[model samples]
Target: MRATALSLASLPARPHKTADLAPGTPAAVVTAPPPRRPRGRPRKTAQERSDGNRRRQLMDGAAQLFRSKGFAATGTRDIAAAAGMHSGSPFYHFASKSALLFAVMNEGMASAVQSQQQALAVLAPQAPARECLRVLIRHHFEVLLGPRSSFIAVMLYEWRSLTPVQRRRIALVKDSYEAAWMPALTALGQQGLLQAEPGVARLFIFGALNWAVQWFAPDKGKSLDELTEQALALFIHAG
Candidate 1:
């Protein structure tokens, strides 16, 4: 039997004023929220399950090989072998190696955007623009330097390997991630914290953060906190 899920959070309520309560009235019962419904959709059909698993394996395996081995050197068979599928199996999911590369790049951008938005959501609603920028920078570092970073890393280094159509498709999502940062940077410009044009400033910020993939190493050098501090110091002027 499926156990009903209950919310661990309590409904917020203020203390009831005695003046507001009737003399003979019983205290109100705090009912448990009608047992919370399960969070996600119904279970996937077996074929859907199989397709989802295969697609995930292919993407994961492709990201690993593409980041470590140049796109040109990694073939469909290599991705398949890494994914534990038969040599021809990847073709079941992707038309060609180029198509697989595009999927990896697309997924990387989508994931990065999702993560950045979530990080911003947790900040206080009225967070200062500089504080928001700091969170943005820190989030970029996490995406670029954290575990499973190969997808974005692949997107960074193998961009030229994509065909024109593939490039166009990836850029659509990439632009949104950039869009998310622009408003905060524009606010900084208004506050005189930024010296360069806001658009150019955005480019410079991304350039600096993305370059960490090339040189920043957790074992050998600065941690994300140090990088975040140094980056803010470089980009934002102290008043």
Candidate 2:
């Protein structure tokens, strides 16, 4: 018994595995919980959230007012009231009415670019160039004449109201939106589906489509789908 005891006592102590320990055991020296990494976007503070929401509200209200009443005639107080904010609140979000106008246009163009990307992404990998153009044309119609289109309509009318710097800034985004069409147009030109040069055809196509904003009333005449087909027919040669 003495020999056995000595032999057992001399054996090295077995390290305790984490799985073997009760969660709260005092002997669990290595049981410090892992530091939790933050998940997803960092939480916005209450004030930050309120500020963002107010800014969006101001833009939306400003867009509606600018579209209905030309930018030159829409006053800051009108925008504030339309946004359900104090008369002086607009200055907190924008330096002046003109700045707000630029914001509206900039945001509108950015949204249009995102919508165009999403529309193009759903196209079949091997879609014909003419079909690609059809998708782009339909999506453009939605951006200009469909529901919640006041933002872009305001942009169409208020371009001259923006400062030179603001106009240049907006033009950058405008070019980005237009650039998406080049590949399809180029392909169509190579296929002899476009009568004019690709660059010239792009300009003519946009001019025609943007003009619809002036006379298109959803209540009267052809639906947007029918309009899209008509536009496609007018722009593309018969196959």
Candidate 3:
């Protein structure tokens, strides 16, 4: 009897059907509904898609204003107005003016990294180290003085305005961007084309290239190709 009772208790519970009920008999068994599966994340709406674009607009406008007027001199209202946003709108995207400044620098460094990668990607797989260095110099000029110049320009000058924590964060990205040039510099040093040590040469080369932002004028001075050639001449010895 105990074994029979255990077997009966162990049996699966069968769902009750109304048709299985005897006439005038109330159904004695009820089953709870199955638990629902958790839902996946919802798709972004059109407005949500535009939020990224708005953030980019704010960064671009802030970069231009910051480069032109200096970070301290520029106000959030000025950035919003330049971006065609309402005066108070920048706060919606950034917690404070310093936060916006850090965003501008962080995003600017990211863009620089991407541009450098693209510039290097186009080289032939077997391209010489000199060619790689040349591409890097030309792209550096474009980054500093070309159509996308404002972002890096802001990064160069407004660096002092960022807190130490922000500086360290931006430095990581900046280091990665600079790392791309090392293999080429090392190769050139191996070939005796580089006059200085590869590491020292890298520092000197960037110092020279970055200084162009102060005096380079597209209309009045050498074109980017001419500048690249001159930089190569200055840094690399003829083989």
lDDT score, candidate 1, position 164: 69
User: Model 1 segments beyond 4 Å from truth?
Assistant: 1-51
Global lDDT of model 1: 0.78
lDDT digits (tens) for residues 41-93 of candidate 1: 85454433342456677888899899999899988888988887888977766
Q: Could you tell me the lDDT of residue 38 within candidate 1?
A: 45
* lDDT of every model, 2 decimals: 0.78, 0.79, 0.78
* Alpha-carbon deviation at 207 in model 1, angstroms: 0.6
What's the number of clashes in each of the models? 0, 0, 0
Candidate 2, residues 1-239: lDDT per residue as tens digits?
A: 85674455445354222221222223212211233444656545443234246667788888998999889898899998987878897777676677677778877888898889999999999999988999999999999998769989988888888777667677878898999999999999999989899999999999999999999999899888999999999989998
For all predicted structures, in order, the TM-scores are 0.77, 0.77, 0.76
Per-residue alpha-carbon lDDT of candidate 3 for residues 40-101, written as tens digits (9 for 90 to 100): 55334433224345666777888899999999999889999987879897776766787777
Candidate 2 residue spans exceeding 4 A from truth? 1-51
Q: What local lDDT score does residue 172 receive in model 2, on the 0 to 100 scale?
A: 76
Pairs that collide, model 2: none
Clashing pairs in 3: none
Which is superior by lDDT, 1 or 2?
2
